[model samples]
Target chain A: MTTAVLQERTHYLNNGYGLKSWLLTKDHKRIAVLYFITISIFFALGGVFASLIRLELVTPAGDLVSSETYNKLFTMHGVIMVFFFLIPSVPATMGNFFLPMMIGARDLAFPKINLLSWYLLIAGGGFAIFAMMAGGVDTGWTFYTPYSTTYSNTYVIATALGIFIAGFSSILTGLNFIVTVHRMRAPGMTWFKMPLFVWANYATGVIQVLGTPVIAVTLVLVFCERVFHIGIFDPALGGDPVLFQHLFWFYSHPAVYIMVLPAMGVISELVSTFSRKPIFGYPFVAFSSVAIAVIGFLVWGHHLFVSGQSLYAGLVFSFLSYFVAIPSAIKVFNWTATLYKGSISYATPMLYAFGFIGLFTIGGLTGLFVAALGIDVHVTDTYFVIAHFHYVMVGGTVMAYLGGVHYWWPKMTGRMYPEGWAKLSALFIFVGFNLTFFPQFILGYLGMPRRYHAYPPEFQVLHVASTAGATVLAVGYILPAIYLAWSLRYGPVAGSNPWGATGLEWATPSPPPTHNFDRIPVVTHEAYDYTAVPQEVEVV
Target chain B: MSSEAHAHAEETLALREQFDTAEQQKDASTLGMWIFLITEIMFFGGMFAAYTIYRSAYPTVFAVASSSLNVTIGAINTCVLLLSSFTMVMAVRAGQMGKRNMIIIFLILTLIFGCIFLGVKAYEWNEKYVEHHMPGQAAFHLEGTPLQGPAKIFFSLYFAMTGLHALHMVVGVGILLTLIVQTRAKKFSAEYFTPIDISGLYWHFVDVIWIFLFPLLYLIDRHLPK
Candidate 1:
C-alpha cells in the first residue's frame, strides 16, 4: 500500500474541502481530529508553563520568575493541563473516534451534541486563555474558597467561567455516550460483546454524567461570591470555607477517574492485542471499571481528611478510599494475567501499556499512603502529592494516550509514522518520566512543600535533578509531535488493519468514509478473538 | 432499501441517519433526555447539599428567614406550576393521539401558566428587594431576625435556588414556544411526537423540583403571618 491509493477514493478527509466542512462537520472522526489539534495546542501551552516552573525550581531561590509569577505559572499549568488537556485528552479524541465504530455503529447517537461538546470546550478554553493573557489567575485549579471567593485579585471569575462552560461539554459527551452505548449497538453487538475500550468509555460517561455538574454549580457559587458577595463560602459572612473543599472535591476526585478510565480502556485493548490473547477475566475487567467509578465517588472525602474534618469521618473516608484501590488492583492483576502465556509483541502501544501498568501501580499504591489519615497528615501539601498525581496523570494517562495515538495513527491518517522514532520516544518518556518524579517523592518525604517557588538550600539537589529529567521528558514529548506530523505527508500509506487488531474500527479502510461503513457490521464473536482475525505478525 | 422507499420513510417518520430504525431513534432521544435531566439534578443537588449544611448549622435563623418568604404568593406560584405541569401532560397526550390543534392549545396553556409562575416570582423578588432583604445589600435585614448574618445566608440560598428554578422555567417556556411552532408546521404526528413527549417530561421534572422547593424554602416554619 502506498500514497497513490489514498487519492483514488474519498474518505472523511478527501470527501470534504475547506475550513467550513471541517468546522461544521458532524462526523465523529473529523471532530476527533479537531479535538486532537485543539488539545495538542493546549498541551504545549501547559508544557511551556511546566518548563518555566521547573526552571524556577532548579535553584534554591525563585530567580527565573517572581514568587507571584511562579504561583501563576504552576496554577496555569495545573489548570490548563487538567481541564483543557487531560480531562478531554483521551475521551474527546480517541474515544470519540473509536467508541462508535468499536460498537459497530454508524456514528455516535447525537452528532450535533458531539460537535456542541467540542465548541463548549473551545469556548471554555477561550475564556481560560483570555484570563491567562490578561495576567494569569493565581488561584490553584482547586479554587478553595475565601481565597478564591474573598481574597484573590486574579482572574478567578474568567477561569471559573471557562471551567463551568466546559463542564457542560463533558456532561453532553457523557450523555451522548450513555445513550449511544445503550441504543446504538449493532444488531448482534450485545453489551457483553462490546470492546473493552467501549466499556471503559461507558463507565467514563457515567462518571462525567453523574459527577461534572456538581463542579459546575460549585463554580457558579464561586463566581457569585466573587461578583455578588454571595458568601456561600466566606467565613467572615457566616460561611464555611471547609464546605468549599467538600463540594469541590466531591466532583474533582472522581474527575481523576474521568481522566484515567479511558486511558485504562486504551491499555486493555493495547495489551490484549499485542499479547494476542483475550483479556483474562473479561467480566471482572469490565465490571471493575464501573466499580471504580462508583467507589471513586465515595472516596472524595479522603481529600478532606487533613482539612480539619471529623476524626471518625476521616476514618470512614480512609477505609472507603482503600476500597477504590481494590477495583484498580483488580484491573492491574487482570492485565498482567492476560499477558501470561501469550505471543507477546512489544509494539509502541504495548511499550506504553507496559509503562502504564508499572506507573499506574506505583501511582495507585502511593494513593493508598495518602488515603491513610496519619500519612495524609504528613504529606498533605508536599511535593509528594505532586509527584504522586504526576505519576498517575503524566506517567499513566499520558503514556497510554501517546501509545494509543501511535497505535491508531495509521488508521486515522492513512499513514504510518516512523515506527523507530515512535519506539525511541516511548523509551525516552519511560526513562525521563521516572527521573523527573522519583526524586520528588524523596523531596516530599523530606518535608519539601508544593506550590512554593523558593525552598531550603538542602532541597536544591533533588529539584535540580527533577529539572534535568523534565528537560529530557520535554524532548521525549516533542519528538512525536514532529514525527507524527511528518508522517501525515510523507509516510507510507497504511493498510486497512495495520496492527492486525480485531475490532469493528479496523474492518474499514485506513481512513474510513463519512458514514464509517458501507454496511453496518453484525458481531458474532467475542472481543479480542485473535483466531477470528487473520494470522499476521508485524513488529515495530 | 430503495431510495423511493427511504424517502417515504423519511417523510413519514423522519428517521435520523445514525439510527437504524425509528423505534431506536425514539428510545435514544428519550434516554438522552432522561440522562440530561439527571445532570440537571446533580447541578441542583450541589446547591441543595450546601443549603442542607447551612440549614442544619443555623436552624433557628433559617426558620425565621424561611418565614420571611410570602407564603401565600409562594403557594399561588406552586399551583400555577402544577397547573402548567397538568397542561404539559395533556399536550403530550394530544401528541400521542395526534390532535395537532389540541397539542398547540395545551402547550400555550402550559406557557401561560409558566409565565404566570415567573411573574409571581418576579413580584416576590421585588418585594424582597424593596424590603431590603437582598443579600450583599448594606441595608439588608429580615424584619423578625437580629441574626443578620445567617439571614443573609438564607436569602442568598433562597434567590439562588429559586432563581435557578426560574431559569429552568424560562427554558421550558422557550421549548414550549418551539413545540407550538413545530405543531403548527405539522412536523409531528401520532407516529412521531418525541419532541413533545420529552418536553413534557422536562416540564414535569421542573414541576417536581418546585414541589420539593416550595416546602423546603417557603413552608419551613408554616406559621400564619400576623
Candidate 2:
C-alpha cells in the first residue's frame, strides 16, 4: 500500500517524452527495457528460424526446403539463437534491470555506457536482420575456414560484423555490471551476503569481459578473410583451419557459461522463493558460479578433442572439463537439497524451475559424456551433440529464462498474468522440449552427423516425432508471448512483494521509480533470509 | 517532506551523505579500474595465446617473420607508447593537483605520441606490403624459407596481433583528444577527474598490451635462418 502510492507518484517515464527520450535516455532501467524489447523481437525471429528447421527435420529428407535453404535455415538459427537470443537473454534484460536494485545502487556504474550497449545491440541486431534479408549466411555459426573464407556466396561479412558489434555490447555490459556489483553495494551488503543471482551474474560478467573480445577479434579476422582474402584461418592460403576452431572455441566454449550462468542465477532465486528456503549451500553456490567461469575457460579444448588437437592437449582439456563439472554439480545438488524438506509450491515459475533442474541434469550429464575423450570421438558433431547443447541451451536456458520472466513479470510491469495458462505453457514447453530433442540423442548415438541438409530414411520416425514435438514447442513458446502482452493491459494489479521474497528489489514499488529509490535503502539483513512467516498488507 | 523544500536542500549540498567518505569512492573506483584492467589482460591474453601456439608450431617461420618485421620501427613505436603512458600518468597527477593547463599539455603530448606510434605502424605495414610478405596475397611465400607453411601462419598472426594493437592505439588517441577538449573546459579538477583517471587506465592497458605484443611478435624466435 505504501509502495503503491510511491509507484503512482514517481513515474519512470521521461519528462521530455519523445523518440529522443527513449533513444538518448541514460537510465539503466530504460536501457534494460530497451534491451527487453529488442531481444524479444530477435527471439521471435530466431524462433521462426528454429521452427523452419524443425519442420524440415520432421522427415529424414529436407522436404520443406532446398539444401541451400536448409543450410541457411540452421545457420540462421545458430547465429540468431547464439548471438542475439541466448547470450544477452538473461543478463542484459533481467540482470540489467535487477543487479543494481539488488545491490542497492541507484544505477549501474556507467549509465550512458549502459545506453550505448543497448544501441550497439540494436545496431548489431539490425545488421543480423539485414544479413538474413540479404539471402542469409550458410556457414553455420562457427564459420569454419575455407568455406567461410572462399566458398560461401552469402553475406558473411554482414553477419560477422553483426556478431562483432554485439560482442562489444556484451563487453560493455559486462564491464558496467562488474563495476556496479563490486563498487555500488549498500553499506551492509557484504560479498557473502549478496544474492546468488548477483554472484552468478558477476561470473557471467567475467566471462563476457574476458571472452567476448577474443570472439570480436576472431570475427574480425573472418570478416577480413572474406573481404580481402587474407589467410588467417583459410587453408588454401596455408592457414591452419583447426586454429580457427581453437580461437573460436576458446571464446565460444566459455561462451556457453556466459549463456548459462545467468540462468543458473535466476533459478537460484526461483528455487529459494517457491521452496521457502534459503538456498542450500549459498556460499558454495556463489563460489561455484565463479569457479565455473574460471574452469570453463580452461576446458575449451574439449570442443577441439576430435578437431585434430594434440593428444596430450585433448587429455588435459578433458580433465579440466571434468573439473568444471564439479562446480555445476555442486549447484545442482544444492538446488535439489534446497527443495528437500522445504515447502515447495508448484507455481508457474516453480514448475519451470523443476523443468530446469531435470533438463539441466540431463544436459550436464550428457556434457560429461562429451567431455570424456573416447565418447567425444564417437559422437562429436553428431545429432547427439546437437541434442546435448539444445538440452542445455533450449531446455535448460530457455526454461529458466521463461520461468524468470514469469517470476519477475509482476515486478517489472506491475501486473500478474493468468497463472493457469502460464503453468500449462511450462508443462507444454517441458514435454515438447523433451520430445523435440530427446530423439536426436538416439539419432546422434546411432551415427547421424549434424549440419547435413538430408538424412537416411531410417531416421524418419524419430524425425517425425521431433517435428510433431516442435509444433507443440511452438505453441508452448507463443502462448507466453500472447499472455504476457495481454497481461500488460488487463491482468490483475500485483502488489509489491507478491512472491513474499526477501531481496531489496521487492522492498521497492512494483515497476520501480526512475531513480530506483526515493531514498536509498540501507540493507541490514542478508539476501534471501526468508525464515519468517509471510505478512499481508492491504492495497491503498 | 515538501517537494520544493527537499529539492532546494538536496541541491544546495556540495556532497551527499550516501558515500560516508571520499576514500570509499576512491577505493571503489580503484577496484573497478583493477577489474577492468583484468579484462583487458584477458583480451590481449587471447591474442598472445594464439601467437604462442603458432610460434611453437613454426619456429623457423616465426623467426623469419620476426626478423622481417621492422624492429627499429616497432621499437620506436614501443617507446612512443611507453612515453605516452608516462604522459597519461602525469595527466592524472595534474588532475590530482588541480592543474588544468598541465593536464591539457600532458594529454596533448600523449595524443601526439599515440599518433606517432600509429604512424610508425602504418609505415611498417606498408613496408611489409612492398616486400610481398603480407599474408594471403600472391606476393606472400615461405618457399626456400625454413619454416615454409608455418612461416605463412607466423605472418598471418603477426599482422593480426599488431594490427589489432594498432587499432587500439588509434582509439586511445581519439579518447585522448576528447579528454583534451574536456580538460580545456575545466570540467575536471582535483575533486573530479574520473574521465581522465579512467582514460589513464585504458591508456596504460593499451601500453601494457603492446609491451607483451612487442616481445611476443617482434622479439620471439628472431635468430633462425631465413
Candidate 3:
C-alpha cells in the first residue's frame, strides 16, 4: 500500500471526532483503547505508592514515614495495584481489542455491554481514588476479619465499595467474551482453529464468571459488617473470622490465575510469532489454559494453612495447589518446545516473552516451595511469600502485558515504537525486577517478614538492595511510557501485519476500521499457520 | 431447524451490524442472559455458604432464632414472589404472541406483584425492628437465649441474605420498567421479544432465590415450636 493510499483510507481512529464519539463508542477496539488509558493511569498511581514503599524500606528504622502511615501506604498500594491494575492489565486492553478480531468477529457478543464494562471500571476507580484522597484504608487489601470490621477506623467501606463495583466490570467483560466465543465465531472458525489467546481468555472468562461474584458478595458482607455491626466476621459477637478467610480466598486465589492466565496467553502468541513457528503441542497448550482455570478454583485453601484451618483441609488444599502447577508447567514446556528448531528473532516483544519464561519459572517454583505444608509455615508471612507473588504478578504479568502491547502496538495505533529503546526497557525491567525481588527470597528464607515498617540491621543491607533495584525498575517502566506516547505521532507508520503475524486481526489494516473487518472473514486455516499469513505485506 | 428459521425469516427484525444473522444476535442475547443469571446465583451462593457454615456451628441458636420469625408472613411473601414470576412468564408469552397490548398489560401485572412482594418485605422488616430483632442494637434481643450473641449472628445473616435478594428484586423491577416503556414504543415483536424473555428469566431467578430463602430462614426446625 502506498503512503498516499494509507493516508486517505479511514479507520476507527479518524472516523469520529470529539469526546462523545470516543466515550459513547460501542466499538470494541475503541473501548479497548479507553480501558488501556484508564488502566495506565491506575498503574502509574500504584507505582507511585510502590516507590514510596521502597523508599521507606531503604533503612531499618522506619524514619521516612510513621508506621501508621506505612500501613495505609502498603494497603492503598495493594488495593490499587491488584484490583485496579494487574487484574485489568491484559484482559481488558489486549483481550478486549484482539479477541473479537482474532476469532473473526466484528465486535464482542455485546458491544454496549463492552462500553458499560469500561464505565463500571472507571466508576469503581473513582471510588478507590476518593478513598485514597480521604486518607486511605489501612485494613490492607485482604480486609481480613475482625480487624477490618470491628477495629479499623480507616476508609474500609470506600475501598471495599470500589472493589465491589469493579467486580461487576470483570464479570460483564467475561460474560461478553464467553458468549462471543461461543456464538459469534465467523464461518469455518471451529473451536480448535481459534488462537490460543482466545482460548486462554475464554478460560479466564469462565473463572471470572464463577469466581468474581463470590468476591463481590464477600465485599458486600464486609461493607455490611463495618457499617451495620453485622458481626458476620467479627469474633466478639460470636462470629468466626476463619470463615471470612474461606470466603475471601475462594475468589482471590482464582483471582491470581485471572491475572496471569491472560499473560500466559500473550506469551503463547509472542512465542509462536517471534519463533516464526506454530506453537508446539498446540492442543496441549490450549487445554492447559482450561486446565489451569479449573484447577485454579480448588486451591484457595493453600492461603489458609496457618490461619487455624484444619490439618485435613490444609492437606487437601496443599495437594490441589500442586495440581495447578502441572498445567502451568505444560504451557512453559510447550513454549520452550516451540522455540527449539525454529527460526527465532529476538524482537522486543520476544525479549519480554523470554523474560516472562525465566521469571515465571522462578515464580512458579517458589510457589511450590510456599505451597508445601511445612515450608509454608516457615515463610507464610515472610518476604519469601512476597517474592513469590511479585515474581508472578509483576515479573510474569507485567512482562507479558508489555510484550503484548509492543507486539500489537502497530495494529493498535498504526505506528511503530523505537525498537532500540523498546529492547533496552525490556532488559532493564528484567534485570531490575530480579534485583528488586530475588533478595526478598533470601531475606524471607532468613526470617525477614513482610508488611513490616522497621527491621534489624542485618536486614537493612538486603532491603537497601531491593530498594535500589526498584529504582531501576521504575526507570524501565517510565521509558516505555515516554517512547510509546512519542510513537503515536512521531514514530513511523506501521503497516498492517508489520511483523508478518497470523490471525484475523493482522488481516485488517493497522488501527482496524470501524466494525473491524471490511467483511467478516472466513477462517479455514489453523491458528499460527505461517503459510496462511501472506508474507507479501510491506515494511516492519 | 433451517425450515423453521426460513418460515419465520419474514418475522425477524433488522440485524445488528456485528452479527451475521438475526438468529445469531438472538442466540447471543439469550446466552448472555443465562450467564448473567448464573452469576447472580454465585453471588447469592456466597451468602448461602456463609449461612451454612455459621448455622451448622450454632444449630440450636440458629433454629431458636429462625423460629421466632412469622412463618405466615414469610409464606405470604413467598407466594407473592412466585405469583410475580408467573406473571412474568405470562408477559413473555404475550410477547411471543405479538399482542403489544397484552405484553404491556401482563408486564404491569408482574410489576404490581413485584411491588407487593417488596411492600410485604418492608412490613416484615418493620415488624423485626419493633421487636428489637435487628442485630447489634441496644434493645436487640432474641426470645430464646441470654447470650444473644449467637442469636445476633442469625439476624445478621438473615438481613444480609434477604438484603442482597431484595437488592436484586429492585434491580429486576427496574429492568421490567424499562421493558414496559420499550414495549409501549412497540420496540419488540413476536420474533424479536428478547428483552421481555431475558427480563422474565431474571425476574424468575429473583423469585427462586426467595423460594430458597423462605425455607432456609423461616421454616428451619419449625416442628420444635417457637
Best candidate, DockQ: 1
Model 1 chain A lowest lDDT segment of ten? A531-540
Each prediction's RMSD over C-alphas, in Å, is 1.2, 3.2, 2.3
Screening candidate 1 with a backbone cut-off below 3 angstroms (N, C-alpha, C), the clashing residue pairs are: none
Over 4 Å off in model 3, which ranges? A1-6, A536-540, B1-14
Per residue, candidate 1 scores C-alpha lDDT tens digits across A218-254 of: 9998898878777788777688999989989999999
Span of 10 residues, lowest total lDDT, candidate 2 chain A: A531-540
Measure candidate 3: CA RMSD.
2.3
Model 3: per-residue lDDT, tens digit, B90-189? 9999999999999999999999988998898889889899999999588998876776888898999999989888888899889989999999988889
Docking class of 3: medium
Model 1 lDDT, residue B62, Cα? 87
lDDT of 1 at B47: 93
Clashes of 3: 0
Native contacts present in each candidate (fraction): 0.78, 0.32, 0.80
- Judge the docking of candidate 1 as incorrect, acceptable, medium or high: high
Q: What is the DockQ of each candidate?
A: 0.84, 0.41, 0.80
i-RMSD of model 3 (Å, 1 decimal): 0.8
